[model samples]
Target: MFRISSVCLCLFASLAIADESSKPGRLTVAQKNGWATYDTELKKKEDAVNKACGSAVKSSYDRSTYPAFDPMKDRTQSACQMAVGTLVEVCRTPDGKAAVKEAVTKTVCRLSTEGTKVSLDGSVLTIHIDPEKSSIVGKEPGSYSWKSALEEVL
Candidate 1:
């Protein structure tokens, strides 16, 4: 009975995988080439966010306190995440991946006025995209990257 149950569970798991893969308009990370770096960086940024805000607690406070408790106190971590998260989410698509690569290449050329090799590194290049103007990602129109805003704190 145990062996039969194990086989049935495996069959169900396989079906679930197949069902997800067959869905339309979904881009699995495995389908994209050269996305490992982005995934790694995303994980790192997520870790940073967790480290920064994970310990935050809600406590009953007096209304007369000079400074009120901040619900989202770690704005810098939040912003950096918004930027990194948007880039990764958009790059899940084939077209988005190509567009981000092209845009980053152009942004590197534009920003390297001092002839520094700042953008030559893939991970470095990935961090500095104009979230507001990027047409590939379908984030909110008013959404902006908080990376620069929270750089010192991060």
Candidate 2:
């Protein structure tokens, strides 16, 4: 099933995400830094991610083990996700790398999917969403999200 495959991908990707934010400086690379991105396309891809999460959360109503929904615990990840490619490339923004590193150390937390009945644990933020399923899906045993290396190019 597409869901299962995606789940696996998310999990494997998690190993990468956990270590990425630690790069020398900012997670976002600037053109001057020789880090480039396909901004328009990245926007579209990020949009897709956003749309999938929003739609999935809207449709994800069936509950199994997590008990009745709590808005705080079960809010949709639509906001955290970007539409850029699920697979992202990373590099430090020349000037902000140090600041970004510090912020991530202080701010990062264990992640989980909000709407998916599948309790993914690889990331605090869900990586890929199935609109048809209206759920956040991922791989690995805990924390659901894409690798940090992937987050930079956008």
Candidate 3:
């Protein structure tokens, strides 16, 4: 599971402008070896994420090494355009494939996105400046939203 860090607003004018649309309540999904979730306020939802990041050891993990993507094999590249640019890694242990089919056929993946790119393969989502443009790559099949879970690197 990917650990979510606290929302630290950088003195970066570029980031402030880019993330303005996302607002104070941004949600980040971490699908690393474990499962972790974080809202804009940095409140963790995963038990493991919390335990690991607790007043115990490492507070967070280096996202670059984790949430790896394989663009060559993923197929969920269509349903991720809603959140482009943002690193939207998906969990590929649940009904990821089914979710993709549903999201595509039903067109129900219209969530929050402003400066992100959409991408989906089999697993993983490469979110960017826009959530609408999130990309996807293949992770382990059966992952939660595998089509858009952990494919591209932000």
The per-model lDDT (C-alpha) reads: 0.35, 0.33, 0.29
Stretches of candidate 3 exceeding 4 Å from the true structure: 1-41, 46-48, 51-129, 138-154
Candidate closest to the true structure, highest lDDT: 1
**Tens-place lDDT digits, model 1, residues 1-154:** 9999999999999999999766554334542322343334445654443334332111111212212222333122233335544444444556554544444321111111122111224323322333233322222343333332222212
Backbone clash numbers for all candidates listed: 0, 28, 68
- Model 2: residues >4 Å from true position, as ranges? 1-89, 93-128, 132-136, 148-154
Per-model TM against the reference: 0.25, 0.19, 0.18
lDDT of 3 by residue, 1-154 (tens): 1232223333366577888755543223423212232111122222232232221111122233223323333323333232221121232223432333233211112222343333433333223222234433233333233224433221
C-alpha RMSD values across all candidates: 20.8, 21.3, 19.0
lDDT of 2 by residue, 57-78 (tens): 1112122222332333433234
For candidate 3, which ten residues in a row score worst on lDDT? 53-62
Q: What 10-residue stretch in candidate 1 is worst by lDDT?
A: 57-66
TM-score attained by model 3: 0.18
Please give the distance, in angstroms, between residue 123's alpha carbon in candidate 2 and its true position after superposition. 23
